[model samples]
Target: MRKQKCGVIIIAAGYSSRMDGFKPLLKFGRQTAVERVVALYQQAGVDQIILVLGHREDQIRPYFDNQPLDVVVNENFAEGMYTSIITGVAHLNDEIEAFFIHPVDIPLVKRETVKELIAAPQQLSKGIIYPSFLGERGHPPLINIKYRSAILDNKQGGGLKRLLALYEADAADLPLIDEAILMDMDTRADYQALLIYDALEAPNLCECYAIWEKHKLPENIRRHCQKVKQTATDLVAQLIDKGETLNRPVLQAAALLHDLVKTEKNHAVKGGEILRDLGYPKVGAIIAVHMDILVDADTAITESEILYLADKLVKNDQLIDLAIRKEMVLNTYHDNPEALKKITRRYHNAEIILQKIQRIIG
Candidate 1:
């Protein structure tokens, strides 16, 4: 089968009334909001991109002068976003099979999300595909070109969302691990939060919880992970006071998701694979070694070491002494000599990390 020709329509014709600054020109990292959204689709190998501009058409138009995309001015953009949507759709090429309607304010939507939506199995069958995170639908719905006329003829009061709602039977929701799908820069405070979120390479607190809910982690395991997160963050705080630089978000997320696949064999490695697949290699690396991390004379107090030690210190949902935790493990595996040796090695590794942390914090 041949690949579908996908395109994206980015609506950047808004007044930025709620936001003190122009949403498209705002900086997310080094790139402007409009630049990032355009880059996202470009990187996803979009066939044709139609950028509909209106509010500050001339000012924003120059930014894409050399870029390979069609930029159309939405003359009636001040009327509403629906006008911009139809303006963008009208410019889509005849050969484009499906297209995504994206708002410029939602610049942080992951590249993987676009690829996932485009490559969805129901792309041909479904008229609309909504990217959902934690059961909430979000920006940039992928619409089949067949609905080009419907979007152009949309006279509904609730905008694009309500117009799409009319075709519920023809739509399907594609659940994604990305929390950025639900994030938008509506206000200054929202933009500030997104800036902080963009700084971290790992998943944020909300995404971590969403992962747990998606995997259906049991209540007991959830409580244990919560305790581990508290213990790990507390350690991070003390260590930072001692002038130790650490990635707190990475550590916290790794600690919470360390036992993600506890029921599976080699759960540490399995959990790591799961997280890495979800676009979090940093957190996955820490969880991968949470069960049996290598500790040596040169081993410093790293995030992996901190997570490993934190896991050992917590039994179930309670923080217990390492010595007591080690005893309980040995007692459970006393009958198997090989298992006992492995357990001893793991406890010894934890001790090395604990001593390293204690030496600095004390």
Candidate 2:
């Protein structure tokens, strides 16, 4: 049988006095810093996330409520980081195949980073996977079930660092452009610095996609389709929630086929041509808007509309829907409020298209 599968224990229990009071309450990009890290593990496709809360559990818990997660309090958190790790891991059941020991304070985690750590079936036994940035190992280390006992035992001192060295984990750290993994909000200065960097760095497409394909995508068109599906499906859900039943066939086909020509001619027209030749003619509109800003010509948010929306919302080639679920897109992209607002409006537009599709569902 397959291994039980891994789970994540993100220790957010610390007071973060280093950053002046509780910094977990701080915003990394769009959501609370903790939410950013939590979304990463969720993207990694872990079984669950247990957010260990302490000093400001009451304040922090409010943001992540109703999300698929569990919250635990570390009464003895001030003693050290090890206690919170112990508490979080100890509460996990046997179903957890491994433990991803992380903290909510580290904000640079990208979904692809987690995928990089989990992609190798090679030596999970020997040690954990660390997504390295320029040769420096980052936070959120992966520990196999075989190492659970050791993690619990070594909680007496030195925290995860000591435990990793003691076990001599077979480590593989890949370079990344998602700097949040390497950056942590330890002080107001650190938080401000990252925010400044976030503003200055205008999202390097090649760099981001290079890491994304290597870590998250399957080296083909699968990931592009995956992102598109998530976007349109999410839009359809919004319609259903608003009392609509979208066209399942069209939605599924268009979301997947929208980006058929992305890596080749890099032309939306070419994408449509490819889809037409492939016998998926209905996706033409979607391919037409693959690189456009908003799929608005008429009132319809075509599959092209949803596809274009999905493509833009992504950062580092990972879905931004789940990330936006807990937080508004406008929060972090404030400087580019127009951009985020356009994205939000596109979502609404997609909802409209889905609503029309649902009307024809009969």
Candidate 3:
């Protein structure tokens, strides 16, 4: 029972009346046309992407033969896209925090854009989140699971647009989403026009990381951050194994930059304040918990702890044993017995955490 924050329903059932035939099967780049959309959803790490198919299930099924995907055919596709939308939600089974509805023709959607959209609802105070481009509403609108019953039993003529019209304010408008959200290939011109979007280019994830790393951080700290990032990644696998949280990247970045503001003594606390001032409130919040128990014990093996533990294991740029690591931390912070005890306790906790993480890395 893997818990997920978002589920995607790809409405791929509509007949491409303008492309003459097989528009979803058209190729634009690395994968096929429909495949591009599927790849985006897969990259976004959604709980599940139910591809609502019709017209040619055999042809569509061939592309995902080796891929793990959920495919369902809409027998009533002739009725409308809403029929397929209803069909896909049936398999969701309370397993998602939100539902993201997409159309397969909108293939150029970026993974980072989807990730930001998925995270907005939980990160914001309003409770629900949606995507828009240049102030206009866009596709793959994310609906929170709290409204599951209304969406499930929507009698507004089986049209999602109608349901949206009823309560437009329930959505959060995200202006930063890429143009792909507004581009669906219903005609030949639309299909040909999709060749321009490259969210993989500037201002996306890789770009963000590039700019983020440009703070001129120290080499030793950077190397240590990377190692802790690896360990935090390993921890995510462990937590997922135990049916716990699968928070992606949050712990990784937190682990990497826990000691970001390393001066001489109060680096952990200082680092948190700096990250906060730098518009990384999430990272700062996580880093601030290094010296305190902001969350529970299990989650205490959190970003800060992951960073602290990862820092402890480093000796002259190499990973060392827990005892030696603990001894080093004790000596480094000789004035603080409490930090030593907490570090040691965390190492004691890492025995189980490391063993579990090794299952995936090893």
Candidate 4:
């Protein structure tokens, strides 16, 4: 079968009103969001790309000078996103058989998703192909050039969704099961969440250990971390045996770095900050909550819970029961009412997590 040529249209012309910062200029891992989006399609072997730059085009255009990409200016960018789409579609390569519309804000989409979206259409040669994760549809939807005329003629102004709705019955919702497909940085909270999510999905476990060593985490703290890692991995193994899915690298890294700054006051929160600064937001998030596991009876066990419970199980590198561990904590903080209250809350959360684990494994 002859290979179909695919092109990509990246819409980076929005005002980014909700993001507070320009979406295209935002950092995703080491590269800017626009750079990451372009690299993703390039890695997938897309024939060509058309980046529609509008908002702050002067600032955005300079970043791509070192890269090979066709950049187009959407003069009507302030009007709405659909105009950017129109500008991109107008610039599509004449020989391109299919193209994907990717918004600059929805960066970090996996390369495999790009491959799958392109491959499915090449085989079928009809209908629109969309990537879905957990029943939610996400960006970079591939469209057959047959709809090019319809898309260009869309002046009704319902945006891309309205254009897509016109062909809903013929669209194929392909499930990619990637959360990055649904993740978009629209607010500070959303950006923070994306950082945490990206770190978990792509954690640098080696750097995590290097940070621990550079800080010269005390030998005792290191031993405790090693023990917690063992305990958490064991629990994770059991959970996996029962068909539970989780990121092993993230779990191990979080367990090892949970006490990174053990000698500091409020080490748990500080440790989280250290990890976040070190570019290990997922590890930091788990470490931040380890000291006070937020137990939600309704929610399933998370890596944070695994790390918290495992830490509770180990007392100075020795596995101990909850009662014994609580006794040790109380003995240390009994004189300080505030410290005692914090310990009480931590244990309360630990108890709930323990119960949930028991139910899962048994």
Candidate 5:
């Protein structure tokens, strides 16, 4: 099938009055928010991007000197965000089949979420496609070029919202599970919270599933991961019930991704490396020891221990006795004495950890 050429329209023309600072220049994590948003679309294979600058064109234009995006100044930017949208749309490449319109403040939308918006036009072929997380609609709505003329002509008053209302019946809402879609930094508090939020938020589950599919994870492995996540969550509930504090998001994500690179040797190590590369160090730490965590029974059970113990208790998706799981591992490597020896050590470590868990929660 021929791929549609999609363009990104990033509206950076607002004054950012609520934020009390220039949002485009603000640091989201390592890079400015504008750079992050552009990188997201670029990583998603967007054909091109048209960045609309208004309030601080000179200040913003220099930032993208070497970047791969079209920077167009909006003289009417002070009017509102709608003018920026119109300004960006006016610069869309003639060949672009669809374009995504979002703001610079929303920099954390996942690559998969953008791809989903881009794909909506091919299937629906008309109207607007908006990404919804939980129940809230998200930015960077992908609009078909078919509505280009209509959008440009609707200068009546309501901006993008009014433009979309004209074709309300034709709008397509693609449900997504990405919390990043529902969040945007609008105030100083929001920005401050975003820094901490970005540091702790796990990679979207949709993106996790995409990675699993991308690696062609076998159905059994996928099921095993799901079961492990369920087991881990149950343990977490128990810990919380006993007034134990834990980072549930990190634990859940680690469980879901403990075997990310399962086909590779030392998959736990490889998975940890992958998560860290993807900017999830905390989750990566837990996944790193899922196969053989060093648990100090003297200390309380930690997230890493929970993941490790849960993994040992699940074999091919079904909750199995730890002894049976260890036997299966040993039998599989019976011919290799050295491998059997390693398995014995792993089993012994798991037994010790299990005793600690029972002592704490039971």
Candidate 6:
């Protein structure tokens, strides 16, 4: 089948009055906010891209020099964001089947989210595909080019949100697991938080559960993960009180998602790979070693250690003594010598972690 021709309109014309800085030029890791947004669509194979600039256009215009996308100036940008949308939609190529209107302030949206939106219109006959996270709609709604005339002709009192409401019957909400879809930079504090979130590369608590629902994890595994998360939380509180610094969020997310691929062979590694691909390398690293982590006299009491120990303490959603857990493991593999050897090694690793936790908390 021929690939759908996708395009994007990145509106970067708003005054940074609330942000106290240029929203498009702010650095998010290595790239500026606008740069990141452009790269997102470029990587998603968007055939055409038009950036609408108005306020401080000169400052942001040079960034896209010789780039693949066309840059248009929205002289009436001060009128409202709607003007920029009209400018961007007018510049879209005639052959473009559908397009997305993204704002420069929402730079952290995952690339996977774009791909999903691009693919949604194929299965469902919808004019607009709004990405909804936890029932909240978010930026960069993928719009069918058929609405180009309606948008250009719109003189409504409200902005795009209000105008789009008229076409609700023709629109469909595509539920996604990306929390970044709902995140945007409206103030300095929000920008700082987004920077930290970008660095951590892990999902928030709500997004983690959304992932579980998206993957359709069995009810039993979900219960087990909840208990593991609780166990890790207790360990984090105790460890923090003892002057041992640990990343509680990373540890808890790993604990909850460690068994993501539990029904598959080599589930620990598989689950880790899945998370790493989803942009949570830190959580992935912890889950990767949850099944059989390396421990020694020099091993520190980090988040990985906490997760490893917490998982061992929980047996099928119930916290059990490490000794009883080991006994059950041994009995399960008693008839197979090779399996027994691996099980014994895992138990030994769990004991070392248990001892370290006891030493810290006591």
Name the candidate that leads on lDDT: 1
TM-score of each: 0.94, 0.55, 0.54, 0.59, 0.69, 0.91
What is candidate 2's local distance difference test score? 0.65
Better of 1 and 6 by lDDT: 1
**What is the full ranking by lDDT, best candidate first?**
1, 6, 4, 5, 3, 2
Minimal lDDT window, size 10, model 1: 118-127
Residue-pair clashes, model 1: 0
Which residue pairs collide, candidate 5?
A: none
State the lDDT of candidate 6 residue by residue for 1-362, as single tens digits: 56689899999999988987899999987899999999999988899999999999999888889898999999999988999999999999889999999999999888989999999997778989999897889977999988899899987669888888999998998888788888899999999989988876577888888889888999999999999999999989988998998888888889889999898999999999988988789999999999888888456687887888889899899999999989988998889999999989988988888788888888
Question: Which is better, 3 or 4, measured by lDDT?
Answer: 4
Instruction: Report the C-alpha lDDT of model 1 over 119-218, residue by residue, as the tens digit.
Output: 8845446878999998889978998888899888876678888888888998988888788898899999999988988888788888888889888999
User: After superposing candidate 5, which stretches have Cα over 4 Å from the reference?
Assistant: 204-248, 255-304, 310-349, 355-362
Q: CA lDDT of each candidate? A: 0.90, 0.65, 0.68, 0.84, 0.83, 0.90
Over the stretch 50-157, how does candidate 2's per-residue lDDT look in tens digits? Answer: 889888688888888789988899999888888888898888878876678888777766676676566544534345666666456777777777777777777346
- Candidate 1 stretches with Cα past 4 Å from truth are 121-125
Off by over 4 Å in 2: 1-4, 122-125, 199-362
* Deviation from truth (RMSD, Å), model 2: 15.9
TM-score of 6: 0.91
Error of 5 at 296 (Å): 11
Error of 3 at 250 (Å): 31
Q: Once model 2 is optimally superposed onto the true structure by TM-score, how far is the C-alpha of residue 348 displaced, in angstroms?
A: 40
